[model samples]
Target: MGIRNKLDISAYFVVGPENTKGRPVAPIIRDAVDAGFTCVQIRSKTASARQLIELTGQASEVIAKTGKSDIVTLLVNDRLDVVLAAKKQGIKVDGIHVGQTDIPVDVCREYLGPDAVVGLSARTHELFEYIKNADVSLIDYFGAGPVHETTTKPDSGLDVDGKRITRSIEEITTLSRLSSIPVVVGGGVKLADIPSLARTGVAGFFVVSAISEADDPGHEAANLVKTWNSHKR
Candidate 1:
């Protein structure tokens, strides 16, 4: 079976130097995985491709040291070229996560091949349209929502009118019901929100600042995982 069939994304950690407040991305990733984060996404708006490849190599190594790399899927955010380059250099990157405007999912799947896990970013309002017309045959999962408003990616969750939008519990439940692939939610999610969000029937809870900017990322990640395990459907 491919990794997607058995991937454990219950506590998905998204991180990069940009989110780490000047700390190296690899150590924070190591801490999160050790604390029970099941998946990791390497994301950066400013890092060059070469820099990202190096970071990916570091993260891959740290995750390996934890001895749970089989269950821990590693993905690079929005940079298909970086993913390809990292793979070419023998780094253990699993796949790529792309937004609506980034590289198309079909092309990503084509290059990365069938064994890779490809994720797509789907916004709240676009769920219906995505359900109707999105070619999800190539996708492994849909990441939907800033469950609350967030500044991590300021342009995200905005409406056509440029107003900030957030996903309500009801909306999230509906999304889970309608999506063909597994759905994971993020953006402003925290420990307290885990019980309710987990009960919404979504597959996982993803986070950026919750773990990356925490005073103790490992402890915070453990708590988040603990909360999800206790309440997840």
Candidate 2:
């Protein structure tokens, strides 16, 4: 409709085990809800279609039981069909998040249909520009950073060992200010850095390992949300 509203600065969870023996995705999500996390996206790459459907089904229930509209968004790391199937099943999720390797935003829109809250990740400005035409309508929000090197996605372009977090924030904030779409920061975000990140002016963030693999993911989720909100006021 009108310019999309500013994104929620509260915690947004990304569901990937990251091989850390962390809590299962379902319970972690349940706890995320309990901890006041406003949004979630399942970002697993290893799970098959059947597995994802099963997982999202459980997540759907959690979202419904809690009455968390837009609280849970089912995002496939790079799978569009999974996203479409999740939608067709009437699985209640906010939307799907995708990245460079996934289907083009236009094709995703054609198949997933309008109204799907599609997100794209951009590590470099060129990659961001790659989706400029796509961003016109096909994309809803953009994830732009690992702001620092992260073990989370070691091979991806962005990620500096906590060193780049500020620079990444600077870059994405600049992008978000100029563009109409919301830009979110991800990768190597830490509890102490949330306020500085907020000062950058991006709408919000997508936290993966920081929340998922934390000693207390739910509590960690809450802290990030709290920190982000404090910065807003």
- Ten contiguous residues minimizing lDDT sum, candidate 2: 1-10
TM-score of 1: 0.97
| Model 1 CA deviation exceeding 4 Å by range | none
Lowest-sum lDDT 10-residue window in model 1: 123-132
lDDT of 2 by residue, 44-117 (tens): 76778878877777777886777765534545666777766777888765557777667777887787666567
**lDDT string, candidate 1, 1-233, tens digits:** 76777877778999888898887778789889999998999998889999999999999999999997788999999999999999999999999999888999989999999999999996556766886578788998889898888878888798778888888999889888888878899989988899999999999999999999988988999999989999988
| Per-residue lDDT value at 215 in model 2 | 81
**Could you estimate the TM-score for every candidate?**
0.97, 0.84
Error at 115, model 1, angstroms: 0.4
What is the C-alpha local distance difference test score of each model? 0.89, 0.68
